[model samples]
Target: MSLLDEKQRGAILRALHDLRRAAPARPGEQYGAPGNGSSLLLSLVTVGLVFALWYVATNVGWIKPLFLPSPQAVWMQLMDVASDGFADASLLSHIGWSAFRVFGAFVLAACTAIPVGIMMGVNRVARGVLDPLVEFYRPLPPLAYLPLVVIWMGIGEGSKVLLIYLAMFAPLALSARAGVKSVAIEQIHAAYSMGASRGQVLRHVIMPAALPEILTGMRIAIGFGWTTLVAAEMVAATAGLGFMVLTASKFMATDVVIMGILVIGAMALLFDLGMRWLERRLVPWKGKA
Candidate 1:
């Protein structure tokens, strides 16, 4: 070989050796993974940074107090609402009312949607009947249906609950159906080969397999339900966090408005955390290889 060709061959061999040495011990090997402690620390740092920014912006008068209240001002308003009450109802009472409406509608949606979704997945008739309806209303914004809901159900608790229920139902049902459709055909065949009855197969095989998806659907549904709360409470509500926020805004009670917004966000965060915890506990095998 010529001198340059010999040098090029040596360089290629060295590069291949280096690349092999740097490769993972096994295919798909993960490295430098952060532990739970690292994750928690990062979360805390992010929250601290956000609060610091908020403090600096308000304290430095970067934003008008009328438009953006200081964190301290919002905190004081929270204390006032807790003690003196907002619109003759305590903060706890408003929270309770909002929670009641959300959970009520959510539970109703879960009970109905899950079964309908399973039927849709398992039976062509059900799919043909319900899929069109679900697809139709799912795309429409909640506000589009609000006037009709109010006219039909009147401006009462029934209307609010129904509106929230409608908001939660479609996504949940679709999730359940998708879950059922995703069930392994081999699992169904195995159950049938073992002489398991239809009911037995559904209960033991289908339900467990579909539970993770159903729970995920529930989480998404609750989020939608919460989003619908302000719209629901706009319908003649006497006591709710939404009502409190809207009432405060009319008079430009900026602190109270910010406080109410914070309370709603905090509650939603807590509930979401609870749902995540439940999912981890109940669906331990989810996403496992």
Candidate 2:
């Protein structure tokens, strides 16, 4: 082999030997290769720069500490949280409640949305019924429904869940609809020509093609849920991070507020990363555009 080919061959040989000595993949398995270290380093560097800027900006009072807390104070709060017995409850406790609310709404919306969206996309009658309602509700803010939700469900977890659901539902429904509609016309026709049933067409052609867009919608919906949580938790939550931020506003504890905001941002980023990973795995052809 030439030099480049020899290098590739050597790498493959090494990989094979490593695999032979290593543990086998579990059922339903794929290779667990190392990820892009350069990209990981770049992300770490970006975060470091952002915190440096934040630290400098707040200390110089370029931005009011009321709005932007110092990095040191925020770090102290994080240390407090990590050390134990912080925030009247552990940080994880608050995070657990918040995650429960977000994911509950997200799951509820997705369960209803994916099916409704598929029906709307694949069936003209269903689409006719759904199109007008989605159009009417899509533009309305989930916060706009807060009053009605409270009146209907009380200012309890039920109402909060409803608000999150409303926040997440519309974008996802639209995405599912788009995905369904984007299924190639030729594929449907070909399936029918092959004497495939309507169900078979849906299963084999529409769902597979539409998964990427559906996932895209789900991601958007989750983001909206995150955005809506501040308002949602404004109701009667006593211990959520949202509540912590809201309460800290009175004491002007900008450090805690900033930390809470950063926590929310980190959570959102993590969820987005997870969705992107799922998208890539589920739709290997998604990045073609």
Model 1 lDDT tens row, 205-236 = 77877888999999899999988999999999
By summed lDDT, the worst window of 10 consecutive residues in model 1 runs over 20-29
**What TM-score fits each model?**
0.87, 0.82
Q: Could you say which candidate leads in lDDT?
A: 1
TM-score of 1: 0.87
Q: Tell me each candidate's RMSD, in Å, in order.
A: 14.4, 11.3
Error of 1 at 275 (Å): 1.2
lDDT (Cα, tens digit) per residue for candidate 2, span 1-289:
4676455445544543343346444332344543468668888999999988987898888988667768888989888875673458778887888899999999999999889888888789999999899889888887788899999999889999899998887888889989998977876675566555676668767887799999999889998998888889988887677877788777888888888888998998999999989987887666342
lDDT, each prediction: 0.87, 0.81
For model 2, the local distance difference test gives: 0.81
